[model samples]
Target: MRYRRFGKTEMLLSVFSLGAMRYLESAANAEKTIWHALEVGINHIETAQGYGKSEEFIGQAMRNGLSKQRDRFYLTTKIGPTKDADSMRRQIEQSLKKMNVDYVDNFDIHGINLYEHLDLVKDPNGCMKAVREAIDQKMLGHVGFSTHGSLEVILDTIRTGLFESVNLHYYYFNQRNAPAVQLAHEKDMGVFIISPSDKGGMLYNPSEELSGVCYPYTALYMCDRFLLSDPRVHTLSLGAANPSEVDSHQDAWDNDAPMSELEAAVLDCMNRRYTLLENDRCSQCYQCLPCPEGINIPEVLRLRNLAIGFDMVEFGKYRYKMFENAGHWFPGNKAIRCTDCGDCLPRCPENLEIPRLLRDTHDRLHGEEGRRLWE
Candidate 1:
């Protein structure tokens, strides 16, 4: 695989890093799968304590002679934004023991996904302090964070200069995080793109229309190359569930010279198709903010686009329910809490009927039936 200088960390991060978030094989097979990645020169491994069995699987694979040369590659496992220093400290120890590593090359403050979550992480006596202590003791070489949060919050976390790298979402479908990627570059922080296929509009199960739009290339390959083509994006996570799935994303490596032609053709088709449903739908512009009841208008509207524009009702419904648990990170009351105040009407450049769309969203995507789908 090709490599990029991962900002401040100075690691030659592989363009296609193995994301160990999905593994469905037996221990022996899991070892073989991880071994194959190493055999193919995948040197960066990203996993999390929360990803069930992932860290343990990697540990077991290493113990079974997957590789004895730990010094050659970078390993990162996430731990906190824990509620307290002690809990976060114990988590670090637990992660080390479970992975059977004396030290990690890098560490992550897992899931600082909102403003308040950032506050919790930076708490003087909380996770931030605990990790610094771990670093001082050489338990980990450096510290960073991962987020499924807004660009604003992600930038806030990067600005602190406490982290050496960052993991955030940025892809073809969601360029909203572009500014965060830029700011991280400015700060010289490593930027790792998370879940390009799964969170990037579920490219694995592309719609028939999407398949046609990204013709000659699977929508997945199109999306991977789209992000890889950009100089600012350091690496894209290839979260392969099975070993065989690895080869597809790797083709994007060093094949960027053809990306300009491919992106123009594919994007024109996709933009034209998606534009058909844009008349009254929200542009996810985030202009209509500070709604008195604290509604996340842009996100709700984006979900609406999935259902209306792409006929992806099932996926739309699944993500809409996430707001119920995501708290202030996703923030705002559901569409039902709009209260018809029209406070957001003037702020919207589209001058669309803000409350009316929220009502439509509430009626269509949110309800007891949809809640059960995710619950």
Candidate 2:
């Protein structure tokens, strides 16, 4: 496995870190997975209070001989984005007792996805105060946060300089967080990217077309290489529910692979797929923005591309639903809000019938209808 300097906290984190979000049936299963990961060189494990039973399962594994390997790993668990110190303290204590650890190397402010959540942690009387108190007591080593917030909010939180690391999402389809990852590097903060396989376009079960496009390398391996190729990305959270599945992740650990050639192949196929000029696709250029009705036209068109070109109906619906009332996070209006406005038409280089395409974008991915491939 390849390791990278995990910024201010100064640990050499593995490029592929194990995440405990997908703990399987039994404690023994979790124990086996943990042991297998350690044997394979993945030394960082991240878990959270919100992930049901994941903490308890890890504790169970530690109790069953796995504790002997404790020093071989760097442990991190998250707690409250709570409004007060007491709640944070209570959660921290529970995490420690549950994990049966003397101290966690990193304690996270779980999910600070908005300005108010950041406020809860930074309020002096809030979560961070308790976290600092714990650090002083030697029960915690470093403090950080994980977020699913907007780009502006993420950058604002990183700029606070209070964190040793920051965990967020950044992958192929979701390059929206690229700027924040770069900012974290500048701030000397560790960048741990969460759910790269599942959220990075559900790559484990790539479609035939996708498989062909990424020939000589599987889709998941392509994604793993893409994320690891960037210096800003310290590690990717690969969550496995079964011990046998861990081998798939192990296969993705080659740092010396010929990734540039593979990337060119994937991009060559991607460009062809996305450049369609029928009722099926849009160029995804943001030049037609500032829709008079306040709609995210380019974004809608991009999602529209999935349903028509890639036949990724479930993912299209899943993401399309994120726009329902997402406000400025997605910004502008839904496709249904367009009023046949010709304003965007003049700006569009593709000469797409703006209103018609907007309606098509909405109609195709519009309902709660879909067959989810897998989680």
Candidate 3:
């Protein structure tokens, strides 16, 4: 496993940190996965209060001989934003007790997905105050946050200078957060890429076209290498469900050689796929934004791009339904909201039939509504 200096925290964290969210529905599997991760050199384990039963399962593992390896790993947990310091303080204590740990290496204010959430944490008597008190009491090491907010909101949060790290979405399929990652790096804040596999266009079950494009390297390995190639990125969270699942996260190469010739070829192929005019791709330019109806045109079209260009209909439906259901964590109405306003039509460099494509996207990808995993 390769390790990186996790920004200003000064901890050398494995590039493949274990995410304790999925496949942790039971204590036994949780213990098995945790042990396997530690044996395989993953030194960081991150969980959150909203990730049902995860903390309890971790505590159970610790009590079942895993505690003997305490010093061998770093523990991190998160609490949702609360309006008051007392509530935040209670959640912190609960997390510590549930995890069977005296101190968490990192404690994040989870899901600062809206401007109001940022305000809540920054309030003098709100969550950050309690987090600071925890640090002073020696129960928390570094403060951070996870987000699914807009680029504007993310940039605002990073400028606060209150966090030592950030966990957010950034991967090969979606580069919207690239600027935020760069900003975090500039501020010397640890950049933890959240859900790189699943939220990253469900690469675990990649479409045959995408898999072929990443040939010689599987989509999962290619995505991992793509993110790790950036010196600014500290780690990619792997939500492994079982011991066997951990093996897939192993690096394709042992050294820090960014973008080897083979990897570059794959990237070139992916770029060609993304830009194929025959696919009616959206190009992901921001010109179609500020929708009067609050629709996120680029995101909707990006999902459409995946569906049409790479046979990723399942991934499209999965994300499309997240519209309106996930709050600011995934703020946007479905493409069905497009009123055929000619505003975005003239601006699109691709001259994509904005309203028509949006309606088509909705028709193709709309399905059973998706609830945010933590919700």
Candidate 4:
């Protein structure tokens, strides 16, 4: 496994770090998986309080055997939308108690999507002040935030010069976040990539069209290679289920042979294919959110783009499943629930016709069922 400097920090972290999102089914199994990763030289581990039982499982595993090796690894966690300063402080204390650690190497603001939330955080009475107090008290080594906003919000956040790191979605398919990663590098802040492989369902298995281009390597390897190709990406956090998954990633990391010309050409072609999906160009800015009805405009649009861009039936199916299983297929507010108020248009970042897109998503995904459910 190769290690890269985490921004300008003195710490050098593995390019592929262990993500503890799915480590809750069995404590023993999670422990074994984490140990195996450490044995194979994966020294950076990331988890979140929002991920069920992830922090507790890591705490249990470390107490069981990893405590001695603690100094050798970099551990990170995050704080989410707290109701107030008191609540935020309590959450951090709980996180510390659950992790069985006095301090986390990196602690981040979890899931900041709106520009308004950014302003709220920076307010003296807001959560950012609480985080700063904690850092001053030595409760966290570094501070940052994780966002799923547009390039504009990302750039604005980085320019605040308040964070030591930032976590954002990034992958071969989602180049939208690339500029943010570059900006993080320029500002000397750690860049943490969250779920790069699973974001666009890329890691599950590449579509046949993509597989054909990748050839010799499995779709999984191609996805990993694509992300690792960018040297600026400090670490690609993976949600590993077992030792085998960690081992597979280890193999990929060890075999960093230069990309073959065919591989480069294939990736180039894929990028071009992705760029062509500009039907309405939503940009996922989420400026028109909290829709009165409950439509997740950006997600539906993304699925629509994926459906048309890849021309892969299975990919579309997977996206449908994601929506259904995650309770986001038809959100309760925004477009799906819009009364055609026309209130969201003037506030939109991309000025997309919100109601129309929601109607299209409903028809495309559920057709008659969606109409009956919403109408």
Candidate 5:
């Protein structure tokens, strides 16, 4: 497996890291997957307190024997928006309890999306102070933040130069955060790409149109290669469902076979197809947020494109359910609760017709009975 310097740290992590989001439902399954990952040389395992049961499962799995391999891996977790410094400290203590670890290799402030959040962290009594105190106490080896926001927030966070690492959404399908990744590299901070495959549901079977455009390379391998091809990406965290998923990725890593001329041609064709798909129209800036309804606008658009491009009916159905079920989690304004305000159009980075796309998603998925299983 190819290894890269994990930011300014001396540790060299595998190009592919294991993400524990999908392991919330089953401990046995999670353990098997984690074991398989370790067996395959994936030394970086990422989890978050926001993801239910993931930390606890990792702790249990390690206690069952995986702990012996602890030194072989790099462990990371995150702290969410704590109400106050006392609460933040308590949460960190709880996280340690759940993970059964005295200290984590890396700890980050979860979801630093808005500019104001920076102020909150830098506040004397805010979570950032708590994080610093934790590090001073040797409770954390390194400190960082994760974001799903605009370039402005990303650049601002990087400029602080306070973090040893930064985790952000980045993938071949969504190069919106590429600049952030580059900035992280320039600042000598570890750059972690979260859920690259699952972003916009890119790794699933491609739509017919997308398949027609990206034929021989198979959407999965193409997506993996696209991310791995970039040297700036220190690691691509994959939410593998089973041992087989790990094995499939292992194939990509182990293969000594060079990209054939045909493969290169296919990739070029896919890139061109993506270019035409967006038409340079939507920058995916996501400024018109807080949809009155819980719609995850960017995510919906991405899944819709995946549905149309790949022609995967089941995948489309799944995406629809995710939106409908998780609808309540987002602020009412940021979701399907949107009013017919054309106000968001001007603020958009890509200048997309936001209302129109929102309407399209509702009409297409809401009518399908199979898609409403979440309801």
Candidate 6:
């Protein structure tokens, strides 16, 4: 695996890092998978307090035999924002004990996905103070944050200049975070892309139309190549569930040349998708926001884009179902919340019928309520 300097942290990290959230099968399997990732040169291992059994799996792997090779990889774990320093410090200690490690290479304030979450972390006697104390005690190294927040919130978090790195979403399917990525790079912060294959439009099970659009490359590889092509993106978390999945991502390691052809492929896919649907003109301008019912208009329309233009009906319904449960991570209600309010009608540069399209989006992608991955 190729390595890059992880911004201000200065750690040379593998372009592909193993995310341990999906490592819930078995301790033996986790060991095998982690061993395979190390064999393939992946040196960054990330887990979280909320990912069920994830920390235990890594700890088991270490105690079972991998302890001797601990220094070969950098370890990272995260905790959700806490209201007080004492509770946050306790959680940090618990994470260390669970991982069978004295110190972690990085500790991120997890899921700062809301304004209130940020407030909790930045509170004088809250998680930030606890993290600083951990750093001073030699229990944590670089301090960072992982977020699923809005663009405004993300930019604000970066501007705080408190974090050494940031783990956020930026993939082929959703480039809304591009500005935030650029800002992070300018601030010399490590930029980690989260769940590129799964959250990045469920590329693991690409729709037939989507697959055809990315002709000459599998959706997974295409998406991987697209993200790594950008210098600002430091690493991508491969949420591999097994040993074989690690091998599948190795091909992206080759060819460090310009991606002119890949760029053309993306442009072609974007242009052709507009022809596939009637109201394909949302443009995601974001001017028609602050909806009276708090519906995420652009996201709902983007789901509509994927469902109709790319035949990603299942993926659409899956994400659409998370509207209510995802909270600030993916805020807003279903498009059905539109009350035919003309408030957003004039703001749309596309001049599209706002209420009608929202209802249509709801009709196309609505399904049973779904839970967030960590929930």
lDDT by candidate, in order shown: 0.79, 0.79, 0.88, 0.72, 0.72, 0.87
Q: Would you list the clashing residue pairs of candidate 2?
A: 294-332, 294-333, 295-333
How far residue 189's Cα lies from its native spot in candidate 2, in Å, is 1.4
Error of 2 at 161 (Å): 0.8
Query: Deviation in angstroms for 43 in model 1?
Result: 1.6
Residue lDDT tens for model 4, 196-309: 666645555666766665567666777777777667777878778777778666546764446668778776766666566565656766677656655556666666665556
Give the Å shift of residue 166 in candidate 6: 0.7
**Lowest-lDDT window of 10 residues in candidate 3?**
248-257
> Per-residue CA lDDT of candidate 1, range 1-375, in tens?
778888888988888778887764566656666767777777888998887788888888778765487866788999758878888889999998888888888899988887878898778887788888998999988788998777778888888888988998887777888898889888888889988887777777877767777888888888888887777778888787777877767667766453676677877776666675666767777878877887788888877776676665655666676666655435556888888988899898888888888888877887543221112
Preferred candidate (lDDT higher): 1 or 3:
3
Residue-wise C-alpha lDDT for candidate 3, range 1-375, written one tens digit per residue: 788999999988988888999865689999999998998889999999989899999999888887888889888898989999999999899988998888998888899998999999779888889999999999999999999888888999999999999999998889988899999999999999999889997988998888888898888888888888899999889898888888877764254568898888988887777665474788888888888999999999999888877778999999999999987778899999888777888788988888988999999998998997756
TM-score of each: 0.89, 0.85, 0.96, 0.80, 0.82, 0.96
Score residue 99 of candidate 4 by CA lDDT.
86
Tens-place lDDT per residue, model 6, 52-104, is 88888888888987889988999999999998999999999998898888999
TM-score of 3: 0.96
Candidate 4 Cα errors over 4 Å, as ranges: 255-260, 272-299, 311-375
**lDDT of model 1 at residue 365?**
80
Cα-based lDDT at residue 133, candidate 2: 96
Candidate 6 stretches with Cα past 4 Å from truth are none
Could you tell me how far off, in angstroms, the CA of residue 210 lies in candidate 2 after the best superposition?
A: 1.1
Candidate number with greatest lDDT: 3
